[model samples]
Target chain A: MRKSIAIDMDNVIVDIETNWINWYEKEFGVKIEREELLGKPEDEAFPDPAAALSLIYKTGFFRHAPIIEGAQEALLKLQEHYDIFIVSAAMEFPNSLPEKYDWLNEHFPFISWKNIVFCGDKRIIDTDYLIDDHLKNLDFCKGTPILFTASHNVNVTKHKRVNNWNEALALLGLH
Target chain B: MRKSIAIDMDNVIVDIETNWINWYEKEFGVKIEREELLGKPEDEAFPDPAAALSLIYKTGFFRHAPIIEGAQEALLKLQEHYDIFIVSAAMEFPNSLPEKYDWLNEHFPFISWKNIVFCGDKRIIDTDYLIDDHLKNLDFCKGTPILFTASHNVNVTKHKRVNNWNEALALLGLH
Candidate 1:
């Protein structure tokens, strides 16, 4: 049995637009400045892309996206074999870890206030299996590495990748 | 079965004191001038702690930390179920990720090339779990957090913590 399982919430479990809206509003005051979204340049996407990227995990944008399709089922099932945890890098600190934990608790019984780790580095959160959407994370991860795919990952053409939960399960032989 | 794992080298899996000594002489001007190891000030680990940190990761100081007891065994067993990755935060450039990978490969097969993530925040590495001596990193994780014990961590007194492979396994119920 897998001892532990970790799931990424955004993109893998939640949509992207949720965070984009929040970032736009908070960083650039773009909610009142809606025209900024219609970019002559992508500056409004992240008012300061470089700084935003560095602080992305600490941003208010996390916890905003809706869980991806089938992520709930996969996470719930994975919980049966592994101690489950949500390893995420959010620039935003929720009012409390319990707030996010409670939100997740509504869906999955195995996930709880104790298992949740909210930090800038998802790697520090220990688990046997960490499902993530970002490729760079896989660079040093040991185990069955699963990549949640997206349009931006197009350039990552090779190197054994996956787009969804079904593919990830099959790839890992969990299917 | 665990599918993903994250490991830390310096001060986590191995001791880097001597290695740092070698680096001090080579990169910086004089040894005692380096100061920190000689019991200098809090921030003066070197002429530039950032430079020292960068050189260590770059020049193999990180690759040479004598393996902590049970480190090899713990990592090997964890690898059976998880895709292990090295999510490290070094101040170095392109050398950060690859150098860490090399150190792992040279020292332990458990930490192979396929799984290694070199980054600064680590929270951004996007793993389900990350291991580090920094309680701050432990405090900042976004998942099922595991705080591995170190000499300095003894004073950290509270919060869920672990000392070695056995304790870590117990934390995840793998033991």
Candidate 2:
């Protein structure tokens, strides 16, 4: 049987961190320094984290997020060997449902709608491997968890970490 | 921590079996006998199971599905004691996404949009209790699995069974 792989959307597939930073700078007139954000919560790293974070949850935000470097090529290659599923914690923002759907349809049209999951909690996902940036999502995975490095999750080291799509593809033996 | 409950939407909460049967009759001009369907796959019981099943995947089918008797009341009452999430394997039918969302908004408006999950595989769901009609869904659950009795699952005996919403309520100590 082909091993099932569940890939997260935010920092793993799409560069939401860059989008957040750019949106914050454009909206709040404050360019947050990366060093200050290291090892700090979003609310602590910025003047108004809630407002800044809320911008991404609005309609059309996910549709506009730039794909992570090498993600498209790596995912296309990975799709040949594994049953890839895009598992996103999208219920927190109801507006994200259609937007995420459209985004996936545009970028990863090869991924069937049956492989896309819009969920609230990651604990319920059962797969052979999970590639995600958040420890909270990886902590309870029944399968092997590979941490995709992100700015906020830089200090988390409980699981095997992959810094980029090349590393992730190699870790999964896709390369 | 509050115990979390994951509820299946199809036959458990909404009467999809009945709707399918009714639709099959209307579309094919052939009335299917309930006995012919017992313990058999839909394909075995129908002239064209693919076509019959495909009707339910259309955009409007889910929006018009009748709620399982007492489901709305039981879920509402159960909501007072536990954190409830609707975990539906809806990604199999892409058109069902917006329809299911709209149906929940109209009927079970009390369920926050945050609590609704649309996914393909059920194995990824993690919760304290899963009330579902399929043994396939319950077989891999980490939590207590309460088999919500449906005609197709009537012969399944591996798990504790509840014939109706009242029985489900009683089993969960809500009665």
Candidate 3:
């Protein structure tokens, strides 16, 4: 049997930061630089933290998040070597589950519905490798935790890190 | 720390059989006896197997499933002694995710969103006890597999069985 890998959806596969930054600029009419927001959590990055954070709770947030660059190609390659599961901490946003499903269906068509997992907590997932952006999710993982880089998680350095899809591919020996 | 328990949604906490039976009767304009469904898979028990199976994939099927008798009370009591997680294999029906969430919210309000897991497979779930209706799910579980009785699973006697919520409570020593 092939080894299994549990991948986080939000920052790992879907680039929520870019969409959020764009949404924040459009909503508040204030252009924010990606560099200026580096190392800051989504809420703390903006002038109005509450308003910026509220975007995630909105209905279409996950649906509109752009696919991370090189993710589709890397995942397709990884699929042949390992069992891939898209695990998202989405139960917190009850309305986002369907949107996340539709988002995965539309963007990552190669990923089967059987490989998707939407839950409130990530502690229950048992796999060989867990590639996630959030430390909270990875901290509890029994598998090898690979930290996927995001602006908010830039300061986190204890785990093995992957700055991009290419790095993740190379790190996993897929390259 | 309290031992964790993973509970199935359909045929366990939610009485999907009664709703499905009622749906079949209303759709086909025929009175069907619940006794006739004993030891038979839902699809095989009805006149139109395909039609009966189609009811599950239809929208609102899971959303409207009636709560099992004594499930809420029993679950609440169990919650004090065990860490309860409602794990459902729902990814096959992508659109049903939000509906299932809403259904849990409506009926099992005590089950926090943090404890719900909607996934395609149960193999990845790590818990101390898995109380599920399907043998396929239980067979893969690493924990104590407690089979929750359903019409389709009536013949299966491979695991610890609980015919209803009351029996389940007693079996778990909550009664």
Candidate 4:
């Protein structure tokens, strides 16, 4: 059987930072620089954290997130070598469930519904490898953990790191 | 740390059979007896399988499914001993995602969103025990499988069986 890899949806494949930042700027009428967000979580990066984080509760926030550059091509190549499951922690925002499903359907049509998981705790997931941006998830994972680079997780060095989709493909020997 | 248990939604905690049967009777003007549905899957149990199954796609089908008898009490008791996760194969019906979350919130209020998982495949779940009505889920489970009795699965005997919530509690050594 091919080894299975659980890939996180947010910062790993979907460029949620860009979408969230744009929404934050549009709603708050402030164009925050990327440097301000570096080394800090999304909530803490903003002057008013709760107000900025509230944008996630908006209906189309998750659905409209831009796909990471080269994610589609990298994922297609990864699919040939491994069983890929797009795992997202969407239970916290119940509204994001269907939106995430539609987003995946529209963008990654190659991934079947059977391979998508909207879950709460990633610790319950058992796979050969887990690719994620959160150290909390990787700390408890039973499989090999590959840290996907995100502004919030730049300082975390406990797991193998991949700076981008290209680096991920290279690390996994896909290219 | 507590040993974790993964519990199925349909036919286990939420009685989908009664809801679907009631829906079919209302739509087709023909009542389906419980005996007729015995030993048969939901779709195959009906005359027009497609039409009957289509009710699942209807807006509020999953949202209104009645909770199983003694489930709330038994689950509450079980929660004290084991980490309980409500795992459901909900990705197939994208519309059912939020509805199922609402249903669980209304009926099983004690279960936090942190313990709920909506996914395509049960094989990815890692827990100490899985209480489910389907054998396909059990077949791939890496943990102990406890088969919950359902009309369609009465003939299945490959796993340890519990006829009702009372039996399930007794088998688990709970009062």
**Candidates 1 onward: DockQ, in order:** 0.03, 0.47, 0.89, 0.91
Estimate the TM-score for candidate 4. 0.98
List candidate 4 segments past 4 Å from native: none
Off by over 4 Å in 2: A25-37, A43-47, B1-5, B16-65, B76-85, B105-115, B126-130, B134-162, B170-175
**Range of the 10 consecutive residues with the lowest summed lDDT in candidate 4 chain B:** B34-43
> Which model, 2 or 3, shows the larger DockQ?
3
Give per-residue CA lDDT, model 4, range A28-107, as digits (tens).
99887777888897669887899888999998999999999999999999999999999899998998898999999988
Ranking by lDDT: 4, 3, 2, 1
Per-candidate Cα RMSD to the true structure, in Å, reads 15.1, 4.4, 1.3, 0.9
The sequence of per-residue lDDT tens digits that candidate 3 reaches over residues A1-175 is 8999999988899988899888888778888788887898766888789998888787788888899999999999999999999999899887788899999999889998778899988898899999999888999998999999999889987799999999999999988
The TM-scores of chain A alone, one per candidate, are: 0.64, 0.94, 0.96, 0.98
Single out the weakest 10-residue window by summed lDDT for candidate 3 chain B: B40-49
In CAPRI terms, model 3 is classed as high
- The numbered model that scores best in lDDT is 4
Give per-residue CA lDDT, model 2, range A1-175, as digits (tens). 7898999998888888777777888877889766767766555666787888778666667888888999999989998888899999887776777788888888899898778889877776778999998888899898999999887778886999999999998898878
**Residue A160 alpha-carbon offset, candidate 4, angstroms:** 0.8
Clash totals, every prediction: 47, 5, 0, 0
| Candidate 3 lDDT, B1-175, residue by residue in tens | 9999999998999998899888988878877788888999766988788988888887888889899998899899999999999999999877678888899999888988889999988899999999999988999997999999998889997999999989998988877
Per-residue lDDT over B59-107 for candidate 2, one digit per residue giving the tens place of the 0 to 100 score: 6788888889999999999999988999998877667777888888888
**Residue lDDT tens for model 1, B1-175:** 4545566666667665555667667777657432344423323456677776566446455555566677777777777667776655542233333344455666675454335443344543445676777765667766556777654465565556787778876665565
TM per model?
0.42, 0.74, 0.97, 0.98
Name the best candidate (by DockQ): 4
- Estimate every model's Cα lDDT from 0 to 1: 0.56, 0.84, 0.89, 0.92
